[model samples]
Target: MAHAAPRSGRLTPGKRDRKPDTDGSPRVSTDVFSERTHLVVRWVLPVLAGLVVGYWAAANRRSGGPVTGWNLLFGFTTALAFMVLCVAVRVAASRMKRELHALTWAVFLGGTFGFVYAQTDKTALRSAVMAAAVGAVVFAVLFYRYYTHEDAEGHRVP
Candidate 1:
């Protein structure tokens, strides 16, 4: 009789082999943890980042202002709005199969930040100028990164 094959309890290999591909990069991981990490990075992290940005915006606006229920309301509402914007951008980029124009989004965020900051009895012009300058730098860096890392189809270049 022919010998039976051994049944090892280990997981099966993925579509790609363990060896490096033509680009000298390892194959994408199919591990369960890796998948979970990807999900968190893709979805949860963006929301969390939005929350942080919103909180900062609200706090900046509230500085030296009245301490009332309105403060709480403003903070919560701003956080919700920011989170929604982030999710929208992510969805749109995914559907379009292209990298989101970080510069445009950065300008939007900076304008939001400046508007909020200007509400705290500060000079609106100064606040806007500062925000725009920072936004420009952010735009430049993100543009370079996205351009280099993604192809025209917006697919990541491994």
Candidate 2:
């Protein structure tokens, strides 16, 4: 058999040509900003969301009343509480097993939703019942996802 000339000016196949760095320093990834961007998105997006939720809750509580210092205080307090809970849940869930992680999120989602719903002048018993129902639904959905995505040892499958 006769050999043919290598294509694309490469003597060897499957080898990539790399350019030397102009500054003589080690090459850095082009995606260096991705990690920082992810960090900002992970925290900042949630904080923004918490703030929106807090505003909604405060508005609901105000019930068309004029904005007052107390109302602003309540909104800020609620926003702080929501942001704290979001961070806590994220950290705790990451460290927990699949079941516990799902449960943690379910509880958080249900409780937050219920609390916000309750601000709409709903009765305490109604809010509790709604929370329970929401919790159950969230638990079922999260448990299903976790079960499908994790193995028997609770390790995630790629």
Candidate 3:
């Protein structure tokens, strides 16, 4: 049998020859501004969310009176604590192989709500029950989102 010459056309192009996302897909170009913006958003958004939750908690948990020094102190303290939790959640999410960010946020929100409710001279049991119920719903929705959007190995898929 006679051997035919190897065809170069059948092989894929070298890395240098392949253009970036020229195959009809939208191409995302990230510059320094984009990168910085992403970083800022990553940190800032969480902090802002934490601050909001903290304020809500403190406001609701306050004694029946106008805002006072103690209320301000409590709000600031809660805000600081929530900021820490947010940062911790960010770190945890970065380290996880699976999607758990939603769970982390849910826990924070639910716990804050429960704490504030209990502080209102309400029954601890009732506060806990309400928090659990809210947390469960949040968890279910977020878990469903994670499940449908991510594969078993945690890689996102369409």
Candidate 4:
């Protein structure tokens, strides 16, 4: 019997490699963990952040005092409120124009900061002014980022 020739790396007229073409474009993620990661980021991270903020508020309010039922209640309540408002703001901002979206987050940040600051015995006027300044700065920064990173149709630029 005659022996056949060994296969080589060269491409033949009737055969093509199964590997996909790589044209330097981004590839879609096929990993199963990606969806789980997205879910955790979209929900769990925000909840954890809210809890941290709540703890900070409670600690600031306590001011070296021992932990009490009232403190726990206040902290959990603040956490719940913060989470709800965060979700609401995210949903609302997603549907708004770019300007409104930036403004929404700015307002949320400023209001949350002001609330936390007020726990430190600061004057209401002082907290308000600080919050306004913070909001202005946040708005300017976010607006510029969104304006540059998104196209006219609001889609993100690659």
Candidate 5:
């Protein structure tokens, strides 16, 4: 009987001896944990920063005035304007990311509390606390999604 042929090195998965492609080698996917770390670094920090600064600014501006009902309306309306302006800019740039929308939403929502501070000044601290709490919760959700999400591009309709 004829002897069986030896397997070629090229057939080996890791030890392939083929010439490298001209463009580039195939990208080796890293482990899941490593990729998640990368996502956290890329997506988490800026989110926290936006929340902190946005909440602090509005809270810091209050100076202990009364919060009349009109003040509440005005505060929310102003924050709404700020949000609309931000959305327009973000939309124009065409750089709108999921997190960017979240950040803006959090800011506009949180900024309403700041507006309240500007008007009534009473419970400025409470508004700040509430905004911070909300911002924290929002980021927590984003962070969880970042680490646990299957796709890197985000917003996969589950």
Candidate 6:
């Protein structure tokens, strides 16, 4: 069988090879800012939430209920639960690169907290609810920015 000449047209022009950098290794870009921000939310938001709860107990749980101490204890416990839930969601969202979703969840949780506070006639709980609501809003905005930044960087969130 006769061999045909190599077809130069099959080869495309401007082919570039991407090699490892000067350290003789491959470096992957992992956006740590989002992770760090999420970490902050995990710890900071919960503590703030706990404070809000304590303040709520001090103000509202102080009256109109037998065993004022017990009332305050319950209020604090509820707030701590909220904090735990929020931290869990924050971690999940950060991993998924969907902070907005987490923030939305936080807002909903704040409202749930508010309902309990209002229903129980606790001023401190009410105050806590208000603070958490405000924080949720801020977190939502920050998370939106974080997601946007990640998208621009061509990160595949999926």
22-91: candidate 1 lDDT, tens digit per residue: 6786565344454556777888876787777666766776786676687777777887887787777667
Consecutive 10-residue window with the lowest summed lDDT within model 1: 7-16
Q: Model 5, range 60-80, lDDT digits (tens) per residue?
A: 444445655654554455545
Q: Report residue 158 deviation for candidate 2 (angstroms).
A: 0.8
Tens-digit lDDT track of model 2 for 1-158: 89985333333323332543565543333332455676898899779978998898899899999999998888888889999999989988977778898899989988988898898889989998998899989999998998998876677653
Question: TM-score of model 2 relative to the true fold?
Answer: 0.73
Clashes of each: 0, 0, 0, 0, 3, 4
Most accurate candidate by TM-score: 4
User: Residue 81: error of model 4 in Å?
Assistant: 0.3
Model 2 clash count equals 0
For model 1, state the Cα shift of residue 134 in Å.
Answer: 2.2
Superposed on all Cα atoms, the candidates' RMSDs to the truth, in angstroms, are 8.9, 10.4, 10.8, 11.4, 15.4, 15.0
Query: All models: lDDT?
Result: 0.68, 0.81, 0.69, 0.81, 0.50, 0.60
What's the TM for model 3? 0.69
**TM per prediction:** 0.68, 0.73, 0.69, 0.76, 0.34, 0.45
Q: If candidate 4 were superposed on the true structure by all CA atoms, what would the RMSD be?
A: 11.4
Q: Candidate 3 lDDT (Cα, whole model)?
A: 0.69
Tens-digit lDDT track of model 6 for 1-158: 89986433213223222454466543333333455676677589778976686556545655655656666677777677767766676566556545655466656566655655564555875658685976677667766766666674435432
Report the C-alpha displacement of residue 70, candidate 6, in angstroms: 1.5
| lDDT ranking from best candidate downward | 4, 2, 3, 1, 6, 5
Candidate 1 local Cα displacement, residue 76, angstroms: 0.4
Cand. 5 Cα-lDDT = 0.50
Residue-level error in angstroms, candidate 5, position 61: 15
